[model samples]
Target: MTEVRGRMWVRGEPADGFTFSAISDCLTSEDTLVWADIYDPDHDTLTALAEELKLNMWAVEDATAPNERTKATVYRTHTFFTVYAIQMLTAVGDSTSTLVKHRISAFVLPRGLITVRLPPVAGDDPGFGMDEVSQRFDELGGQQYGVGALVHGLLDVVVDGHFDAVQDLDDGIESLEDELFDEDGPKRGLQRRTFRYRKDLVELRRVVLPMREVVSAIKSRRLDAKTSPELNPLYDDLYDHVLRASEWTESLRDMVTTVFETNLSLQDARLNTVMKKLTGWAAIIAVPTAITGFYGQNVEYPGLNTVAGFVVSSALIVLLVAVLYVMFRKRDWL
Candidate 1:
């Protein structure tokens, strides 16, 4: 399914009757800017659009290719790049959350910006919504700064989504930490949850870490007048978000690792305590066995075949067992 929608702004105000065919005419004026959003475009649609926009064929392929890494490539005519918007999915009754990636590729030109929204590789990911991006562009005064405002609005939404996903993962990790120490907490479940969280964090880091490079590539190219001086701080601020998200992801990876290792250590400690208690009980049992065995011998030194002897042997057994029980109890071995 191919869906195309866009608007043209002339002299910082929206121009009516905007269409793909009119892009060339709209760009004739230095003050005119275009923002086109294409969703799930097929090869035929892209090929035709590419012919019209003079987009690099390789860049078009990268846009539609499955699992393209987050990156930016500058061509002689324009800059092409890919980025992922993240969605964190947590199932009902699931202690851990899963990360879903939505691929958003774009071509940054001097007077126009074309964004491609691809379907998610898996899961029900609501890919990036360009309506919100459009609204954001307007909110940021895209009419005044031209393409720079549009680019900032687009990336601002993306980076904000990344922040939200990171926060979700952080919450999941904290919940897992709470479960780790609870005496009645899920024993086997804790291990499974930690593994799941670690896996999610890895996926998140893959999607997040590369954003720094992508954003930097945009700033360095400067692409004619795409970004004005007013938008520099905005992009810099967006870049900071990318950096913070990257660092937060790194920290989370380490945190989940520690949680996994700590779970193992706690299990080992519990096992040792169990073994010690068993050993104490075994030692207490051996005392009675040894005392009776001595009395049972055919030529026993004492306590043989007499009422008085029977009482004496029984007394010895009771006294020794009682003493051992008290000692073990005091040491928390019972």
Candidate 2:
């Protein structure tokens, strides 16, 4: 099983793991700043945290659920946020078929922050990069940073993930375009990939758009007094990042739609080409069919008795078909 525990960061230093009994001790510790990070804790641990931190039951429930929508909530003394971090795979083998997303729940209190990360399932570790943000927070000296800064740093990582996923999508689209236009290639695979990419973009937008509101709420300073005024700028910076990410997602969605439309148009053009070829052959054969039917009639006909007449009739039919074919070719309809 994946291990779960809480680590306390105080004034750029990490305290050993904090247990239930240690909670009050750590809370009373003489640290200018302290953060409690919980990694995939059990229900009991969540309950204890909820009680100790005075977090709303609903917020704790949402935190434990994996499919919770990206959102922000203001508790009596803390702000909670749920954010999604995306990881894209573009490998050529079995790895290529899998897409992984990491959903992280964050709780920001007046004196501390809590991050709960769920471990990846077997064969599906897309890996999270929370360490980088934690390191940066530590390096900056945690006391100087408020909960808003912590939230911003974490969100920055998440948005960076979005940027990387979008870049991967862009590269995938370019490859798909190449395959679609290749003269001797089959386009079905490219078309399928386009549809899949469009779906991915849609899902990405679903997760990202709500996050815009979450960041906006923080930047607007809607949180209670537990949130510091100095941290408003940090939230503002995060809001800008969310705006940029939203714009990028919209642009990518448009690009995916364009690719899908282009693929459909190509398919339609191909179908039309096939139909034209069949129609042209049918027209050519119709000329011979009519001539043979008329000449083969039982009644005495002007061209029926003479071999020369038969040859002339046949030549006329062939000549008519050849001329029609050339006309169609010149008109660019064949």
Candidate 3:
């Protein structure tokens, strides 16, 4: 189902009963700011809203396009952009962690902002909650600062979600680090989990890296002359957050790479240790084989077939084997 919720503020105070139909009329007032959120909008629903807002058709098409890259575009009438909200489900028991991304697109007009979410809907998920964005708007006095405030509130929520996803991935990486040095062997899932995290990080980096440009475009094209002075600092702060998240993701990619390489190195070291111990034991066993084989010779040397010869050979075998064992043990090869 297509669900659209609208909110308006008049001269810094929120007004009730705002709906999608009233958006055009409300935009006529200079003192008013409108925000409408449409959830899982169908093409028909989006087209209707686009006609009402007189939005650029190309921007509308971009919004509905499948797997659109995160970006911002400035048309003459409005600024359009898309961003993804991220969530990381940490590994549980034998399962590897998962990274989930939800798409949210926006049209920033001179007097208002409209957001469209594409889903696999997450019911009451704060990450995609219009109410949470609304509450953020209210808390920040968004109406007074113009559409920029609305944009900021929405992006703030998104960036925070990115931070959360990055943190969870970091925690997962730490757990994997602890498992890498196991004396027995790495866990069977170690490789699988590392690959999963690397894949997830790549996906996250794709979503996060573009956010820098997205925020910059909104600041330069939409906010500079139009929005209140107070909101600029907020955008600057928000931009910092975007940069930090982007940097954190890059660092995580490096960390996962390290974990993978370390796992291979540890395996090689264990293999070499096993080979050395085996070689040492084989050397010790060969002493008795050589001595007994000497005794098995048919021709008599001295005391052949005598008890004295048997005792002498057995003593020499035991003595040589014991010496080899002690030497190998001292060298930690056995």
Model 3 agreement with the true structure over 44-82: per-residue lDDT tens digits: 878987998899988899888888999999988889999
List where candidate 3 sits over 4 angstroms from the true fold.
92-97, 121-127, 182-185, 223-227, 294-301
Ten consecutive residues with minimal summed lDDT in candidate 1? 89-98
Q: Mind giving the per-residue lDDT tens digits that candidate 2 earns over 148-200? A: 56666677778878878877877877787787778975555666577677777
Give lDDT: candidate 2, residue 178.
80
List lDDT for all candidates, in order: 0.84, 0.72, 0.86
Model 2, total clashes? 0
> Once model 2 is optimally superposed onto the true structure by TM-score, how far is the C-alpha of residue 25 displaced, in angstroms?
2.5
lDDT (Cα, 0-100) at 225 in candidate 2: 27
Question: Candidate 1, clashing residue pairs?
Answer: none
Look at candidate 3 and tell me the lDDT of residue 216: 94
Model 1: residues with Cα > 4 Å off, grouped in runs:
92-97, 185-187, 224-227, 293-301
The best-first sequence of candidates by TM-score reads 3, 1, 2
Q: Which stretches of candidate 2 lie over 4 Å from their true place?
A: 5-21, 30-32, 91-98, 120-129, 138-143, 177-186, 220-234, 302-307
